[model samples]
Target: MEKKQLFRNSVFILFFLCAAFTVSAQVRVSDFRYIDNIEGYWTMKTKLGLYAEKWKRVDDHTWKGRTMRLQNGDSSKVDDMRLFLEGDGIYFTIAAVRDSVGEPIRFKLRVLKAVGFVAENLQSPYPQKITYRWKDTKHMDAHFEGKDGRVSREIIIQYTRQ
Candidate 1:
């Protein structure tokens, strides 16, 4: 009976330790450091063509990026983006080349963690929420969700580090 009790106690203690470790392993959003992980070239293939997105650090607190199509060894710019830390939070903006007015749609970073981040723009007509999740160092997923009129839609893109 003593040996049986000892075995039970050991199993219970091991389970408790595992639960504690799992709870502590979750990441908390403290700052924008995780955003730097995306500084490089990323690519995704679509039915239209192969598209690429490249990111460059403008300063310690800002990054500039552009999405383009790779065709016949030439690239056409689709959208320009800027991500920066401002006033204790981070913001993301994107401007399409056709928008000559130079106003970019803006999103505020609402959720940030070691795994990824979520940004939302309630005023945007299309995508009100944008989420980026890292599968690993070489792969990431981008999700855009919003409502167009009363219809809801979502787009998910998987990007490979290039």
Candidate 2:
């Protein structure tokens, strides 16, 4: 009789857990899709210098990356980056590589196409945009553009697999 009661209690607990999971499963996970497409070590070079970007999947719907400027034999962190999907599309946030003292700048991947994705943060100084355009499997270009007051700025860095 004791054995039968223990078995029934176990079955009841299992059923409750399954029901809980089913209810929570209706919630969505992050949707960082294009990220998986660009998961690898990437390096960019331009007239100014060289930069490096690295990406890796954190989970099904989240990816994290780091960027740095490299010169001679030394490298410095450009930014710490994160991409994740909350509702419809992916969102991006970036912070200083060494210290995240301030609020992170935020952006949304509002534009995603076959070629690439663009993330932009619109603020008073002028919206800053980062674009990753794919040329082919082994080549791509990462561009950054912004405008403050009357000054306009743009940087295009050509990238290849490293």
lDDT of each residue in 1-162, candidate 1, tens digit only: 999999999999999999878644442334678887778999998777888889899988898988899876777898888888877668888775112455777788877777788888887877888888988999988798999789999989889998
Misplaced by over 4 Å in model 2 are 1-31, 46-49, 96-101, 124-127
What is the Cα-based lDDT of residue 130 in candidate 2? 77
User: Candidate 2, 133: how far from true, in Å?
Assistant: 1.2
List the global CA lDDT of all models. Answer: 0.81, 0.73
Model 2 worst lDDT run, 10 consecutive residues: 23-32
Clashing pairs in 1: none
Q: lDDT by residue for model 2 over 63-129, one digit each (tens)?
A: 8889889888788888788878766657777664122446766676756655777887666234478
lDDT of 1: 0.81
Q: What is the clash count for each candidate, in the order shown?
A: 0, 1
* Cα error, candidate 1, residue 52 (Å): 0.8
Deviating ranges (above 4 Å) for candidate 1: 1-30, 97-102
